[model samples]
Target: MTELLTVDGTQSALSQRYSSALMNTFGAPKRVLVRGEGAYLWDADGNKYLDLLGGLAVNCLGHAHPFVVSAVTSQLATLGHVSNFFASAPQIALAEKLLGLFDAPGKVFFTNSGTEANEAAFKITRRTGRTKIVSTVGAFHGRSMGALAVTWKPAYRELFAPLPGDVEFVPYGDAEALAAAVDDETAAVVLEPIQGENGVVVPPAGYLQAARRITSEHGALLWIDEIQTGIGRTGTWFAFEAEGITPDLVTVAKGLGAGIPIGACIGLGAAADLLQPGNHGTTFGGNPVAAIAGLAVLTVIERDGLLAQVNAVGNHLASSIIALDHRLIAGVRGRGLLLAIELTQPVSDQVAQLALEAGFVINNPIPNALRLAPPYILSKADADSFVAALPGLLDQVEAG
Candidate 1:
């Protein structure tokens, strides 16, 4: 057996070594993950952890799922990387499957990551002959130059000075603010149905519908960035579906391929034919292996009734967390599996670390918001176990 890794100073040593070798873009690395299976992961020193964050909401079916493994292995053995010049079975099939999920007719452009997907959509928006874009104040599109232009955080935008011009920011969930910003000159109004990176903030009722109407009236495209909220993460296939609105451009990634990196920028209605040949291209955008992995993920989600499971288990998990009756437990907020617990103090990260030491894995996206995006296939018992351990973790954070 591998020697167990301690969660204390020894882990700090390993982290220090990592900092020496790598540029610290994301500050220090969390515990070095060694292996993962189902909803659990093992650290470099072999300490087991219940991974509630799921690689920042990437692992929908969980880690090392047999279906995902088999699909990728078989596809690789048959045909791996081919250029976009040629079409692959899985590639075309996955695109068709995605279109089938949406009521609106559209076309898809695949990419290797969420940022790339948004970049492709950004270029498509430019093709509308309108350069202006309206986005939310706390929305996170991606890290690419074009995506960063529309992404609303000034800290992220200020560092990369001179982003693409004609972008406007409005307060999220405010239909009036969105209407005030979007006009006939605007190419698209981009939104996250629920702002994931801003700590799982769900919008007000009728917010999305109002945006759709306002953008439609302005002759502007309504783009919903579903990168972190799509593909069964929020119980619905797409969160916008729950709100009863169809966007002109929809970007998706993260859980689409379970872990295999893939993203799609889908254009609906009149926005479909904006890009022609030579408008955009990518080498590894829609690799057959990645597409096969996506098919496997979608297949499992439908076959195993994971959507219903997500709703049932998610409701229970959120209710249980709220029932803890601790001062730190302000409330549980979110839909489906994408839940966040608001802490009274700014010790959410401390609570997360303490929980990790106790073999539970969670994250604090904000100082007082503990985010949880466990696998769609997560069992009720596992969720209950985490809830049971929460009081102790809160106590540890409080003591510290």
Candidate 2:
């Protein structure tokens, strides 16, 4: 029989154990979480906290949702996984459903993560007989070699030198810069609509449309990385839907499976058949369990009208924070539940720690940006509570 650990064990003890055993990749964890429900998490010391980050914006239905739980359980009992050679009902159904969300004819290539999805799209772009890819600065596609080539962060790319070349970096949201960078030799123009990891920076109006127009004019494909902003995160099925432009390639992940690992690279129009056989594949992608989980998440979002809820709650939170009139809070950026509170001073790390002490879980994605990507199911009452506590949290950070 295995011995059960008690909550009396302090987080420091666990941190030491983790440091001794695990790789020094993520550094030391802040808390040892035991369980979660809805938008709350309980730590080893029995401290409960409102989870505003929502697993880095991947828990749209909150934690341990009943629909996802039941779907995963039933599907696992019936069919867990099979070779990609054999297709399951849920796999076909999910692909069809995702294509329907686009309201267009397209094909999907499933993967287990956002990086894999970008890698698959990278390969498809290569098939266009062009090697030049125009990407934006401050963009974070993924950590893989191919995806890393397009990511603009120097700290991440400097260590991993000699990445795949022929990729050009342009200033994000600058239509003229993007147009000047692209030509007939460009294979695709990859962009993230909101640049979530870069402190939720939203591009200027019509930026996406300009990219679309420019890519079309240059005979290059337009690829939108919607891994962080898709599937009801931005109060729409896809963020590009608001821009009224059809992209050649769309990559999505994060909240698609409502916590289960799944991602997709969707090729639209003629780009659908770009990758023929023997080009790309995955063993665990599109498996029955993850597909069912994604189906359950989509079903719950539509059935519960979570998109409208997200808009309402997100607006309230943003407005409330702005209403605080605190000198520390510079402004709020982003749409729907994907939001960032820009601080006048570089005290985001302190604010996140203070918020955690106040029973709220938030993230400091950058030095001066506090990001809040709470679940779509976050109640207005909980949002109001967070707003009520914001001023005090800022004061605490300022005091020190």
Clashes of each: 1, 0
- Candidate 2 residue-wise lDDT, 9-88, digit = tens: 67788778889999998978988898899999998778999999999989999999998999999999999999899999
lDDT of 1 by residue, 17-135 (tens): 88999998988887887689999999877899998999989999999999999999999999999999899999999999999999989999999999999999999899988999988
Which stretches in model 2 have alpha-carbon errors above 4 Å?
Answer: 1-8
Best by lDDT: 2
Total backbone collisions, model 2:
0
Clashing pairs in 1: 5-45
Task: Report clash pairs, candidate 2.
Answer: none
